[model samples]
Target: MLSVYVDLALGLTVSFLLLSLLVSGLNEAVVRLLSIRSKFLWAYLRDTMDGSDAQGRSWLPANPGEVFAALPFTRDPRPQHSDQPSPAQPGELPEREDKAEDAMVKLLYQRVQEIDHPKSGRTSIANIPPGRFAVALMELAASEPDGVEGFLGKLRSMGSPLYGHLKGVWETAQRDLDRFRQGVETWFDGEMQRLSMLYKRYVKWVVAVLGLLVTLVFTMDGLEYAKTLLRDNALRASVTAVAGAGPGAYEELKARCGGDDPVRCVTETLSQPALVTMVDHALVSVSFPAEGDPVVRWNGGAWWDRITTPSHWPGFLLTYVALLFGAPFWWDVLRRVTGLRSRR
Candidate 1:
């Protein structure tokens, strides 16, 4: 009797673990398809250069999106823009409204559109090394006819907040280019940390939505599965055996597929026989409606009930909540439980 409960516990854990992996895989594919990382990175750069907050509220005296557009790093170096002004042409001071800064801004905006939905080739890089960014910025400042000091004067005349920021960095570096680059790198790193937090928050919502969808599609009713496991001795023993057989494969999969490389992890792990078998068992445990067809027709039942009977709601909710705990959480639990069983 004690062993029966143990098997029931193990079976549910295994089921949830498999479902979590499926959700994780789908989440990765969705993220990649949407180019979410690239969008976040671009947003960060835009906010910084435009002197605006995340909500586009400006706190700075002057916008530097124009200055940023002048930098070569933001524009693609390909042949399509061969006839355009050289990115290094910042040496030529602003002419008129028709030819100088306005044209560059238009070109940069076009580049942004291309980045968001490219007709061909990969998306714009989601990450830029701090060192590379620092180099491009410093070189832009140095490219002026009178050099860095002259560039600072132009910014000061315009009451640009970026001038004050870079002036402090220049002073801290004591007029040394290498030290200035290093200081900029440190500043860029701090900004990247904030971007990382924002990206994580975005990912959390993706996980929540994806988990709910996967749970509903699989009809994974936790309470029903628990009742079945408790009542059927043969089914309980079989699930226990499968659960016991899984640890070796689980460890191998964990090592090969880590949190860092989610795309490859999803591609490889979902193809394994161990995961496939677990998913089969999970489907077998699903509870389908015995009365009217839940899909095609609805009788006098309440609108909500037509979606899922009241009795199954708790189980569906439970399964979805468990999935929100994520694959790594269940993986850890599974490892510890198997270790205890082995010792016994």
Candidate 2:
């Protein structure tokens, strides 16, 4: 019993350990894959933006003429001016030119003020209202020789450092993801192999247990058979006759008793030495009538039928306990093997 308990405990411990390893490996693989995906997304977005610093650093010139020169020719066709209109040249200014110059100066001043007081809620070319920044960049790109294609080529050649940083992270993460996936697959395969091995082992154990149970059941039947034989008066009479007891001795004993009723049968059976010896032999050989009973006589049933009756609760309980303890490990092994087969 102690050996059986130890074997069961060992089997359960191994099964739990295998399950834990498989779960932990799968969890790590999932986390690594998610991390790789996140890095990939970040790299893609950074590449798309061309690494323009997201901190709102101003790149445009403070001078109006510089701003005008930077704007596409289609938007600002006038020649750039170096200095403010002089008093002597005031009369040279056309009404439309003066208004255009005032608008340009005001736009430049607003841009400069936004740069100086960045904390103040304001917008720049990068954060142009609504879809205007997109339109402006598109216009600038289009004004170039190869339009957006040329701009993209330059951006790629320049190699945005942000993309490099993100790429490094992504590559590292991807390698880890691949390794984790391989490990998980390997772990899963190993678990399946272990389960297969354990299943075969469990089946062997089950067969042995079943054989023991069958043997115990048959032994109990044999014990009941011997008990029945001891209780048979005809058999006992023949034995007594062979032992030189007179023929009338057996016949007169039965007649005096008027037949075998419980009380009279016991009294007559106890009086015969040969019958007592035969009963003792059967009791000793069968080792039945256990400790509590110490004596068992036939009750008009076959050995198997009597053994299976309510009196055999101890044997039944023991068999049930063995099955209960062994079944879970057996079931887990079966389930794992089935899963492996389905995957294959």
Candidate 3:
């Protein structure tokens, strides 16, 4: 009884680990092809810099002339005008509006563009160090005619909440340039941390969708695999033997996955023509729909029923839920389970 349970557990773990690798590889490829990380970062920075004031005034320049004047670091010297009704002069100041914010937006974009490497035909800054952000702000401040004080003057002109936060930081830094830059860096770090969380939250939905698709494409029904392992002693023993073959075999398997970088590994592995053929025979033909759960067949019921029997949805759901734990998670689980099996 103990041996049966151990073999079942080992077989299930091995199967899950293989399926996870496939899902993770495909996901990495998708992320790269779409340039999701860079796009998300660009969006966060744009929204943060361009958020409106409480009085409904935009942080972007209301005037095209002012926008052009603020573009000191931009590649193109020519003005890029939008369709706003009115254009304000650079020197014009409103009692309620902040002209300096226009400059800040321009400067922020300049920084983003400086680091914006193109991926999949889209340009965006994938990552920016907090130190670099702090440095950029300080440079903007130093460019003012009155230096830091003039910069503070611009901050004071703004009615936005960002100004209030900067006011606190400036006071805390005692008007010292180095200390102020450090404070800015700290502020940027906090914002990046929040952005990181948001990025992960959004990406999880994409991951879940991909996981479900992979589960269906391969028909990786966890419940079905478990049942098979329970019934087929030879299959269970074969899977368990492969897993317990020691660290050398495991390392060799990972090496075939394209070195250490997850993205490259996944892309390289899946791009191979041999992988499709290998998938048919690998893991006892689990991925071959014809050999397992025939996705299309003629049955006496409805077409949908023939394509997908009602009994398979539960297994598909189980596989998808397990995949959400991700490849790294399953890799660790495989290692631990194999180690335990070896010890016993």
lDDT (tens digit, per residue) of candidate 2 on 1-344: 35434434444334333333433354346434333222222222232333322343222223333322332221222222223322221121122212222222232222222222211122121212213323333343344466444433433454433224323433544635334334434433454455445434433443444534433433232233234434444445544553687666666556645665534564445554332333232212332432574455543345455345776545444433443334445455545644434344
Task: Give the residue spans of candidate 1 off by over 4 A.
Answer: 52-123, 154-164, 234-306, 340-344
Q: Evaluated with TM-score, which candidate comes out highest?
A: 3
Clashes of 1: 0
Ten-residue stretch with the least lDDT total in model 2: 88-97
Candidate 1's TM-score reads 0.60
Between 1 and 2, whose TM-score is larger? 1
Position 271, candidate 1: lDDT:
44
lDDT of 1 at 205: 74
Which regions of candidate 2 are displaced past 4 Å?
1-185, 193-216, 219-302, 319-344
lDDT string, candidate 1, 108-203, tens digits? 333333323342243445666777667656665666767677766665654444567678888999988788889988888877887787567657
Model 3, residue 32: distance off in Å is: 2.5
For model 2, state the Cα shift of residue 170 in Å: 14
TM-score of each: 0.60, 0.18, 0.63
